[model samples]
Target: MAKTVVQEFTKGLWAEIPPFRLVLGLCPTLAVTKSVDGGIGMGIATTFVLVCSNILISLLRNVIPKQVRIACFIVIIATFVTVVELLMQAFTYALFLQLGIFIPLIVVNCILLGRAEAFAFKNKLISSLADGLGIGIGYTLALAALAALREILGNGTFYNIPIFGPSFQPFTFMVQAPGAFICLGLMLAGMNMLGKK
Candidate 1:
């Protein structure tokens, strides 16, 4: 049982990592990754929603009618998203603004809904918790990594702290919209190559 729980958790890290392996949650993944702070912020918010909603949905899975399961999942997800938004607004208003619509949009993030319908709703509570944490952390890591690359190249900083010498010129293009797609494409290609091996 313990091994199974561990398996459920670890799978989200690499085997089914939302951004790279699964190619899920691209909206915020692309939009908010220009800086490490934005990436991490959005990731944590999504994680919070994912874990909370997963737990509630799992607890009520049997109670929900089959015909309305999808609707029920959305409602549950939206509730947690509102909580996250309010908390962020009160504490980290800047990040709250930085993340903006993406926070509320978490209600529609495929990772949450997909996990609800595919894993959480059918699984035991403990397994659902593990799945949520694993996936959430995986998503966080993906955002942080992508943000680090973009920030370091585009702004010559990591988390807004300078790393390169003053003489270094920032590659401004890396932080732009076109850069998001190119960088994501490159990362996807890399993941695919590694998967083949």
Candidate 2:
């Protein structure tokens, strides 16, 4: 009846996916998903912060006082978020520009702090690693799926490759804010459908 380390990891992929299955971290998810590249960029950046913060928090769990633990977690999470921002700026400047402020804003993402307080603070090193990775990948996949749909519908392109023929008309609105909300809503509905099956 005990869960394996792999189960702890894999659960984040579908069972407890954030911004969708778990309904956590919707801000950046909707903010940067206009294009597959930007969405993936934000996803990886968040994943980096998530995994690094989770590992560090798990390691320091016993050392941190319960009263001040949230502050410590934020400091730790912010440190990694800064690292991700710098790496994105240096290595992926274009995607960096596309994502803009959302990169640094990852520090406030609830999913990172939620995992730190709820899971990493109480779990072992490997289990925390799996949980972070699973959650990160789940978030990345969700962003990529949404971005793909938005790009294809709004721009008639997949990663700017032009998926639909020239005759296809792009629904430019699909890449806008209203489109983000609509896409997110539809995606959640799809997840619900899948969950019911």
Among these predictions, the greatest TM-score belongs to: 1
For candidate 2, the per-residue lDDT at 141 reads 95
**Candidate 1 residue pairs that clash:** none
For model 2, give the 10-residue run with minimal summed lDDT.
1-10
Off by over 4 Å in 2: 1-3
* Candidate 1, position 143, lDDT: 94
TM-score of each: 0.98, 0.97
Candidate 2 lDDT over 1-197, as tens digits, reads 13778898899999999989989889888889899998888888888899999999999989999999999999999999888888878888888888888888898999999999999999988999999999999999999999999998999999889877779989999999999999999999999999999
